[model samples]
Target: MAGPNSDPIVSATTAAQLPPGAVVLHVEAGDRQSAEAAFAAGHVEGAVLLVRDEVVTRPMRPGDGRHPLPSAEDLADALGRLGVGWDAPVVAYDRQHGDNAAHVVHLLRLLGQDARLLDGGLAAFTDPVATGPGTTPTAVAREPRPWPADMLPDIDAVAAHAAAGGVLIDARAAERFRGETEPLDPIAGHIPGAVNAFYGDNLTPDGTFRDPEELRARFAALGAGPDAVVYCGSGVTACHDLLAIERAGLGRARLYVGSWSQWCRDASRPRATGPA
Candidate 1:
């Protein structure tokens, strides 16, 4: 299992500091056209664009949130096309902070692959940028494997965790958590009994993640531990908190992928407003 000691985060002042032979990915949270446009403008040398819509997620459905996890076979095929073998070490980054990149890294880690996020993202990367259609290595063969059942919990499991007094963290902005404003989901409040821990708080002002010790302290204040369950509006940004948790040397927390989108769809599952 990958943990904090596995070097789940990396900072590179130059390309030389990046892990040798690692597959570098410029992960974008938007559509393919936008991702390609951004990559074409300029990006880290030898990095390939991994658009969330094209590779990591599937079309949204009624039960699943806005961004659903792709089938194991589909994800394997997408990675294979990018020449990413199961054993290859991967380093993912985005234009700004690593929310999108952390999501990809979280998925990769769950698949038992060695994946890390580039600290501070592109702005902190001092390496020279290369423009135009970047390099595309020859495709490699990959095998499909079931997503590890233990790390991901459905809505029922999340409810049970909350009912049983386990830590349930809502990784949305304070306003959303407090039912003041909701930009995406229809519902404004969070799951009942959930504590608000905005994912952005995991980072420093410059956008790099906080020190592991600091992250440990932050989550501790929220009563979170290894068994904590984390969720966000659509489950995409919640991985930011999970990454921070692991970086804090806390064991990997379970992810409720359905998140607020699915939870809010059913008015039966209780909801709460105001500060947690």
Candidate 2:
């Protein structure tokens, strides 16, 4: 399912057209048990599995936000167990318009591995489904590579980026960005000088990403480019926007992993209200 130059997205129809031996991954956001239950019912044939917590993240720590990323060593182990060879063509899919899938795809790409998201997610696929326990290949003993330093930005880096006129795109909903309502982090509003580009705007009514040209225009309006950085409530959904940016051919943007949760923890970082 790798697109031209390993494009970051693939239609489910296009995914079905992939040659044999391409590794499929079912990415779902849920607790461990719920994910297992869903997988037991059925999944894409030969798809590797990644549940929200087990494969996508680590235990939350004080000031670490709701979805702290797993250590690179841990992630490498998980990848090995999934049989993701050094050059394997991997595809990640989720029902939520690639919200969860984008997270995994972004991580893989960050690690210099080739991967793509299933555009429109699982609903768009018409292939036969396999049921019951899925197989996980024996863990490969490849050297664990540390997550690229520049791919993720800490709170300090985010502040500096904004101060230096770098783009800091908040992927939260407009209301949340405006401090009008916040059901998650205690603090309302967003980082000062940060612009809101609600992640949902990247998709169409059918849940597939908007056309590349349209996406380019949308992000171009937001000053998106190599210097732009993206953040969401906890960092998971921000990957969705990053993926969209890449699909728009904007190149890889930095991610503020600690995001709002980390920014709000200090109570000293400035927050803005009522949009940019």
Top lDDT prediction, candidate number: 1
TM-score of 1: 0.97
lDDT of 2: 0.81
**Model 2 residue pairs with clashes:** none
Q: Write the per-residue lDDT of candidate 1 for residues 190-266, one digit (tens) a residue.
A: 99899999999999999999999899899988877668999999888999998888888777888888899999988
Candidate 2 lDDT score at position 262: 79
lDDT of 2 by residue, 4-107 (tens): 23468877564457545667888877786888788777677777678867876888888687788888778777777877766777888876788788888888
Worst 10 residues of 1 by lDDT: 1-10
lDDT (Cα) of model 1:
0.88
- Per-model TM-score on C-alpha atoms: 0.97, 0.93
* Global lDDT scores for all candidate models: 0.88, 0.81
